[model samples]
Target: MQEILRKGLEEMIMKEALKKVLPLVGSVAMLAACGNGGNKANKEAGKTDHNGVAKFNMKVEHEGKPIKGGELRYALVSDDPIKGLFNPALCQDQSDQDVVNFMFDDIFIVDSNNHLTNDGLAKYKVDKDARTVTVTFPKGAKWSDGQPLTVDDYIFTHEFIANKDYPGVRYPSSVGPLVGAEEYHSGKAANISGIEKKDDQTVVLHYKQMNPSIEISGGDLLSYVIPKHVYENIPMNKVMSHDASRKNVVGNGPFKIESLIPGESVTLVANENFYKGRPKVDKITIDVVSSKNIISEMKNGNYDIAGMPADQYDAYKDAANFSVIGKPAYSYSYIGFKLGKWSNEKGANVMDPNAKMNNKKLRQAMAYALDNDQIAKKFYKGTRFSANSLIPPVFKEYNKDTPEYNYNPKKAKKLLDEAGYKDKDGDGFREDPNGKPLVIKYATMAGGQNDQTLALAYVQFWEKIGLKVELTTGRPIEFQAFYDKVEHDDPEIDVYSAAWGTGTDPDPSGLYGEHEKFNMTRYVSDEHTALLKDISSDKSFDEAHRKAAFDKWQNFAHEEAFAIPTLYRTGITAVNKRVKYYDLVSGSEDTKARLYNLQLTQSKPVGE
Candidate 1:
């Protein structure tokens, strides 16, 4: 009778496991069917939307409408002050780019749906080889100062970022595919040979090979064109050192920088001569505040919009005069391992040689140990989802066929024992062959309360398996410095928590490609590298072969256990409902704070 009971219990547990896995499979299947149907419908209609350009005969009624001016006060959480007005090439982390996006425009703009949309910018085409791309500036487009927008501006930005003398502010991933970008940035080449001005309004780019979809989209959204006539004579080294030049930067956008008070706020006024037409709102003000102060300001009506973290949602969800907008953000949290830094000069690994963590099997086992669903529920209040793959489910190419590691503590212990870590000393803790406890340092940033709480929970989770973990936190700037060291492969840490904002393109090359400077894990394999290269160089966007290649890449990343994906959180925004005359764009769903299509309602007072 006892044997029979044990068998019955085992059967029940197996059924429970199947129930858990079935939902994830069903969700994926439904998503795939929807995506395939959309594609088929578009193809059958003989036309499709490219980026944000729609095929339907929809009219833009507000294009020639009268402009209504008003002041928009935004609440922002910013650490570093605005250091320069240049594109991220001068100071990447400073909140200045937010101001720049309002003041100046890029050659190609990305709409809320992650599609390339033409603003004042014009037509772009790629050659059959995919090596050369040409961009043409729209006629009548003018800078804020009324100077004609020209191709020379795009050429200047390309050359400026590729210049060795300039500050290393651009993401290396942005310039990785340009033909001469690496050599120029490395100081090996005199100048970039990839960028050339074909005429007064045309600029051409040459790449080493065809780039992945993400790289192309990033190039479009990130490469903000600068005024050549204004900054051509300025020395590159002194670019960030001059306040007058940085404060009064010129651009071809709907607004221009009016004033920036250090550590306080930045104020902007609409550009009367904006090429697309003047913006409806008259002024925009962004006030920097601490995370602790964001809620109070929002409640008091001192701020129009605030990006509240997931943990704070419950506290403010039922608040009067406020509505929480939730949408999937490309950002995801993960735990990375320092793979190449395991060995020391004595030919001994500083970590336990017999630790299952040293083997990929052990790492995958740990991933299986954690109950991601429980973490999402108890910690995030069910506002997030467990992420099993590097790419989020929103992307079409994400592979659902790959097996996900389910929560199974017994399986984790079994794998650990198989890899030689055992409780031989009978001390109730697993130990290596040398009798040392299996300990790891888990480093996280102390920038906010959420990070602290999450770190504490992770520590507790590891402790349950007889693993000793030390949690360390540091200031945001100091933490970023430590992260940079890990990216360069000089890891002083064993494990660390990080968040990656996946770009509009869902490709994993930036995180998994062998040559990627952002691959913090130092994890590389020949198979992975080849697949990344193939995807990056594939230009046939609608080809079945390209889709298959991308699917393969996603599948490989899921099986490798390169990193432990924690959760995918939605970007939440709280906005005053009184403000009207704005249409939410698809990609802008993360935050309702975008100024692109915003307008002041005629019924409301300007200062209300």
Candidate 2:
């Protein structure tokens, strides 16, 4: 079995290398700088831990003491919210992920000090030379349904994702070169030889080689244990629409979904069977609120706590009844073009002949025209700052060679002119090399005025350099439809403005890798693939080698003008005075300010 696994890995690595030669593409804790002043709000910089990465914190205070049964209402800031498929295998977007967290627990959770801790895991050991991980579940671990969550459930999560018929996108870059992964994903093998269910409570995973990423990015932290009894019979193609996934999925987390209203809202109840003591709150409801309407809703007391918009911060910061808080979040806002096409059958990421964004010089010109600094100041107040790379400067491995695209209209015009884009037809906008009107189609989400506000700024900047622009402004689609078009390679979209709230792990290949479904940017290149592989799943365990590989990939992607990095965000969450225990402030990773930790204050009057 071990030998078969070894052979499978060897074959996959060869194929991976050959492909590289081708071309193509919030958690926290609380520390406070609280209350309000226009100047005080801007200085709400994230506290840093020992590692130098910015720390995301959670802080809330209520005069009344904690009590259980009240419902915490959160007005979600998106047009279209989650669309079923609540299972870990298919929940891709932030809207779905926000709710998924209540049910599923990751293998590791970064602690206050920026180190990985086995939050849900009982015992985990890594054998560097053997390239293996052995995990044991707590003997009495129970699911929401009161069944033991054993080793089979964990192993089956890997098997399901490795199944070629399964249509989820996270496994490719998230878990690198697992033993037998290629054969398993290709259906050449019935099972992955690297995984072994040693007993009812324990499981073992074998990798092609050892890398530091396994501590966080490997299937360990990424796996969502599935009940084999419930899922084994479901067809892979129908899994997204399966009843179990949409409505009845089970997990070992502290809370469980009592009801989900597709795009409207999600209702959760404390999981009595949870290994952690039942959550302090008895019920929590997340209701969808359009970005344009969240302010009104907050004023009407329709929302207990939600993200406060930058424009509205001044109104709430000094408001005695509101807790306006900001902490640096490990996230980036950017714009990307669709650069390649995906073929499901061939599994090939190749250049699209009809791709509208094929010109690298044009992309660079636009990048040069972007004034991230100006936009950050005007739109974000003090909540955000200019970012030069997709990888924010907060990370230790952030490359110093990252190209900064500071605003330069002259440079933009020069590049556009050199690239043969000229006003041949006597119009203000330039024309392509073939004399076709050069127009960029910018697609963005519709729920918030902020999207349009930011889009307008982008349009003005590009038009200053003589580029014609058409914005997706007439009708706004909900988050679900917006992402569907973006990820499915909607031909109408030339560029899309997007943001990513990253994980504790530094590697971001899940968003940039060719095989990753989340690689919405559609960038494809042999050089990129090679560099990603080296830094993420290096052949050697040497620290210096990995750092060099990381810098190389960072600089290569930036120099190629793959995407325009906008800014790093400061998270803003405002809670009414009555809302208590807004969060426990744990890991500085991706999370909604925990409503599970919330309790209503008995002493405070409604809307106080």
Top model number, lDDT:
2
Score each candidate by Cα lDDT: 0.55, 0.64
Clashing residue pairs for model 1: 112-587, 113-587
Model 1: per-residue Cα lDDT over 131-168, one tens digit each: 67777886677878888877777777677766656654
Q: What is the lDDT of residue 485 in candidate 2?
A: 83
- Name model 2 segments beyond 4 Å from true: 1-58, 217-223, 299-301, 449-453, 472-477, 539-541, 579-585, 588-599, 603-606
How well does model 1 score by local distance difference test? 0.55
* Per-prediction TM-score to the true structure, in the order listed: 0.77, 0.85
* Winner by TM-score: 2
